[model samples]
Target chain A: MKLGIDAMSGDLGSAIVVEACRSFLSKNKTDELYVVGKKEELLALESYSQVTIIDAQEVLEMTENILAIRRKKESSMVKTMMLAKNDEVDAVLSCGNTGAYYASAMLFLKRLEGIEKSCLMAMLPTYNDRGVALLDVGANSENTAEQLKSFAIMGSVYAKNVRKVSNPKVALLNIGAEHHKGDEVHQETYKLLESMQEINFIGNIEGKEILDGDVDVVVTDGFTGNVALKTIEGVAKVLVKSLKDGFMSSTRTKVGAVMAKPALKQLMNKFDTKAAGGALMIGFVKPVIKAHGSSDAIAFENAMNLAFDMVSSNVVDKMKEGLK
Target chain B: MKLGIDAMSGDLGSAIVVEACRSFLSKNKTDELYVVGKKEELLALESYSQVTIIDAQEVLEMTENILAIRRKKESSMVKTMMLAKNDEVDAVLSCGNTGAYYASAMLFLKRLEGIEKSCLMAMLPTYNDRGVALLDVGANSENTAEQLKSFAIMGSVYAKNVRKVSNPKVALLNIGAEHHKGDEVHQETYKLLESMQEINFIGNIEGKEILDGDVDVVVTDGFTGNVALKTIEGVAKVLVKSLKDGFMSSTRTKVGAVMAKPALKQLMNKFDTKAAGGALMIGFVKPVIKAHGSSDAIAFENAMNLAFDMVSSNVVDKMKEGLK
Candidate 1:
């Protein structure tokens, strides 16, 4: 399979992309790999004969107006996704400005055969050593009840393919678990989800239920989902900071931190975004994994692993079936 | 000022209420203190001769059906709010079931003169010394854009009065800080909040900005508020559990836990709901504090303190002015 990668974007830039290419190509055979970005940035990963660079003069600098990054066709992220649409590459991976990548995904790659709009999905930190997929964490905000049901179908398929959860339970995130909970859209979505036969539609899940691991996928509009996702991130940051302060408050606590290093590392890794590899914008013609913006070589390699599995999972076909 | 406190409520119902009553009544003189609830429960706080037990025979059990509780007129929580509304008591404080207390408040204490709906007032966890007030965490999921604007006014007044923050910066919670960054109602609310000259309106505050202490009051409809509030709670639980597990995992860590007890205690207190007390329902005619469901005497005492200050500050008068 040929893979297209955006090498100029993200915190680590081309350095990690080169390493990720080296690691993946060394492990398996590929037809061809197209690396997109500025020539200088792409040249860093130019060692492999099978790998080729497509330089775009306009760079989507991370520090620049990231909102305006979508207009730059020369940007590595947009060009790479464009290549995937033209079938120059089988799949696309990006660690770029997420907004730019999302815009280009819609502009070039386009949504799947039946999906009205594609969803940006990330795995949630769950209680049962299992993962839950949360959609539109910062994507579409004002979705219709039908669109929310569609999200359930896409989320179910994505969780099965990526998380390896055979029969994923899907839930709508609402104010409460009761049938009459939430506003008009949510209440209407609740009815639709409850009646849907194709998905493993669980009843409404409260905000607290997201951590319970009771459902394999939690669905909500972008507004609520984005707030929930960031709030969780903010809370995690606060908790981590508090823990760090707790461990360094005095000499005894500092020594305790030394004793608890192993456990602390394990705990950190458990909640870390790295474990999920990267977020996938599914419901496209082919798999697309958006690596974290601050990705290093390890994170890039993990994203590559995710991209590989999506290629083999036939998730697109499953999505088509669910849509049917 | 007269306060009607539910004598039998909360995790340590009578003891904590009695202690808080003992502390509060000893310092502040009021017309009369009415203790409502079971006769036996009220008798526990009889040390203050000025404290009268108004035998409330109908007990609306905590954690029971809220609809049922609303029906019980003679229940302590309901009766207390009724007493406050009828000018029989100055204010009412309950450490009982939060949902039931809110139900009782809405039904009896009622919304402020012009406010559309009363909001659940909470001091969210923050790194700053002064906490930010978040409203409508669970009171009402369905709120109009006007209700949200009113919430901003109510939240701002409470933050200023109860916390004494001068010109508290009030912000509407949305996915992003941009002008058109939200769904329909949010966009409308943003427009109103931005244009309104009645308050110190900050632009949109994202979930992460909340704990950053940039704003003193964050206003949103109950759905998003509850989701954000619960997400923080869930993440905190995850971190605390992992911390405990980390400490007990090995002999070295157990020894370290002993050494780190003081700092760990500090960390625990920071995130502990039992120590943080209860959330107040803003926009009510009478001051009502809704303690966490699992509150201990310490948390209950904290809620009592909030009520004490609410009464002393004559915060209702301030909100009355804002609403009018």
Candidate 2:
């Protein structure tokens, strides 16, 4: 399978993306990579014989607005999106401005049939190795009932085909588990989701139960999902920092920290966002993965692996079948 | 100061409430307490000379509907609300059904003049000893612009007078920190908050910033606040559990666990919800504190101490003056 990488889009310099592509190509020697970036920088880097370089003049900054996507057609990110649009590659990946990346994909790749909006799905770590897929983390802040139901259908297909969860129990994220709880949009969406027979629709799940690993997929509008996702991120960050401070408060504690370093590091790594790769924008013609802007080479390579998995599973075709 | 406690409302039963009151009385002998509960059960427990038992024949379960507050007039929770309404006690405390408790307070205590709604303010653990007070966790799921503005005022006063933050920095909770982010209500509320001179109105704060200790008060509508608060709670719980399982993986790790027990325990306790005390229901004629349902005797004592502090600070009166 072939993949395209937006080397100039990440917060880290394009060198890291080139390094990641080189590493992935070394492992799967037959697979081809199109590294899209400025020509001079791409040529300056030590090249892999199997990897191809695609040149563009402009680079999209992280602070750029969504309008930049429309204006800067010669930008490297937009060029990468066009490659996927023309089926030049099986998938495309980026770590750029999220809004611009999303807007670029919507403009070039287009949405699938019967899908009103595409969603960003993140794999949230749970108790065991199995994690749950949470959708629309920040794709569309405002959504109607019909849009939400479409998200549920799209999320279920992704979970089943990509994550390999059978019958993928899909749940609506609500403040309360009761069917009548939440606002009018949620109440109406609950009824719509309940009527759908194509997916395994569980009732409403509360925010506290999101990490319990009971459900395979959780669906919500962009606002609540974004808040919930960031809340988890914030708490984990604070907790780890506080724990480190506590362990360094005294000499005995410092000694203990050395002994506990391996176990504690293992525990902390489980909550690391990079381990989950990037969020995938499903319901598109080709899989588009959004890696974290601050991701290192390892994370970018993980995103490439995720893109390969999506292509191999034929996830878009499965979603098209299910939506129909 | 005289305080009231719903002894029958907590999950630990009247015994823990009685013990907590005993502990509080032992610290402050002059203060009096009225323990509201079933007559027979109250008499069955060992009594203190300073404690007086108020007869209440009914008990409200956690699953009961909000209408149960009106139906069960003789319930222990409602009886405690009536005690505050009649000015028989300076403050009221309960660890009962949250919805029913909220409904009971709204029914009997009514809103303070100039206040449209009451909010639940929870003190979240941050990096340092200092914490931020987040409001409207589950009170008004749907709030008007005026109501959100009111919540900001009430939260600031509570932080300054009760939490002793001097001039507390109040922020509107949104998905993004930018000016034009979030939905319509948040956009309008941002403009309203910016115009208010009474509050130390910093602009918007995202969910990830809640525990960073940068802001003193974070305010949002109930829906977003509740989801964010619960998401924090869920993440903390899962992280601790996962760490424990990681520590027990091998014998070498078990030795490391023993050495790290002290520092790890101290770090975990920093995130404990009990250490922060119960959530306060503000914008009332009197302070109504809701302790966690599964609170131990120590947590209950902390809630009692919170009530004493609120009464001593004359929080309600100061809020009344600020609103006027």
- The 10-residue segment of model 1 chain A with minimum total lDDT is A61-70
Over 4 Å off, model 1: A42-44, A63-70, B29-31
Please give the RMSD to the true structure for each candidate, in Å.
Answer: 1.9, 2.2
| Model 1 Cα lDDT, one tens digit per residue, B1-324 | 677778665666566766667766666665467888777765656676678888887766676778876578777778777788798877777878778887777776667788878888788767654667888897887688999999998888887888888888999999888878888889999999888888999789888777766789999889999988888887777777877887788898788778778777887777665565678888877787777666665566677777778888999888999887
- The alpha-carbon lDDT assigned to residue A250 of candidate 1 equals 90
- Residue A204 error, candidate 2, Å: 1.1
Off by over 4 Å in 2: A29-31, A43-50, A70-72, B39-50, B63-67
What interface RMSD does each of the candidate structures achieve? Answer: 1.4, 1.3
Chain A, model 2: TM: 0.94
Tens digit per residue, CA lDDT, model 1, A1-324: 788888878887688888888888888775567888778765656778888889876767665555665577667777888888898887899887777777778777867777887878888667655878898787786788887888899899888876788889999998877889888999999999898887888788877778777799999988888999888888888778877888888998888788777777867877787667888886788888899889888888889888877777878778888898
lDDT for residue B251 in candidate 1, whole number 0-100 = 91
Look at candidate 2 and tell me the lDDT of residue B116: 87
